[model samples]
Target: MKKEGCCLYYSRKSPMDDVPEEMTPIWSCTNEKCNGWMRDNFVLSVQPRCGQCDSLMEKSERLLPVLTNTSPNQKKN
Candidate 1:
């Protein structure tokens, strides 16, 4: 059996080698004790609250897969 988390299980290369990545907007919890965050585009609110900590959130960015909003209510611009 190949180790997974404890060890990297790769075929030829890392699975994320060819995937695209970008600086995506996200909301991070202000409470240092909590590791809570969510993608900014996933929520419609101007200022979103942390769902895990229920604390105020701040805008931030993360290197994540390029995603597009699929919400039917989302307006095209």
Candidate 2:
């Protein structure tokens, strides 16, 4: 018979594991406590606001995957 261990351990996979990413332009919330950010290209307005805290966001950079355009006419040069 084997004895069981008393310690409880857990391991979680990182969300970014195996995903290709690059430093891209983004907007981060100005609020110090907020960790909200958004891709610059995805925002509809010239000035963007944080979706999480409703605060003004500032220009920033983040490591993210290159998003592809679905339009056939939008081929990259």
Candidate 3:
């Protein structure tokens, strides 16, 4: 049993802590009030529009792990 005033606090690790990350292309909404962003690899078209506000998105890069599917037709074994 633990005492009320003597408890220890442990912070949980972030979900991305163990995953490999890289600087990849990203798209952010141009609208000042919109907080929309998307991984460039996940977008269907070269120029993607913001799904939240249907506005044009600007290209940028961010430190994020590879989260997009590179092979769409590859069979899973």
Candidate 4:
């Protein structure tokens, strides 16, 4: 049995460390009270509306994990 109170462990790396990220294009809702956002290239619309608030979304960019979207809906013919 390990002594719980006498433990002196220090982690060099946090379990919740942020993933590798990059500046990526996205669309964000214009609503001031909404936090709706989505990746620009992964959507099916030319200009997507906010799914949460049904509000207008504008072009934006954010630091996010580099992702490869393999969804057929996102493919451009």
Cα lDDT tens digits for candidate 3, 1-77: 97677678786866666788899988999999999999876787767899999999999999988676776743322
By TM-score, highest first, what's the ranking? 4, 1, 3, 2
Task: Choose the strongest candidate by lDDT.
Answer: 4
Compared with the true structure, model 4 gives a TM-score of 0.71
TM value for model 1: 0.71
User: Across residues 1-77, which tens digit of lDDT does each residue of candidate 2 receive?
Assistant: 99988998676865666678889998999999999998777776778889999999999898888775455543323
Judging by lDDT, tell me the better candidate of 2 and 3: 3
Worst 10 residues of 1 by lDDT: 68-77
For each of the candidates, the C-alpha root-mean-square deviation to the true structure, in angstroms, is: 7.1, 6.6, 5.8, 4.4
TM-score for all predictions?
A: 0.71, 0.61, 0.66, 0.71
> Over 4 Å off in model 1, which ranges?
1-14, 74-77
- Comparing 2 and 4 on lDDT, the stronger one: 4
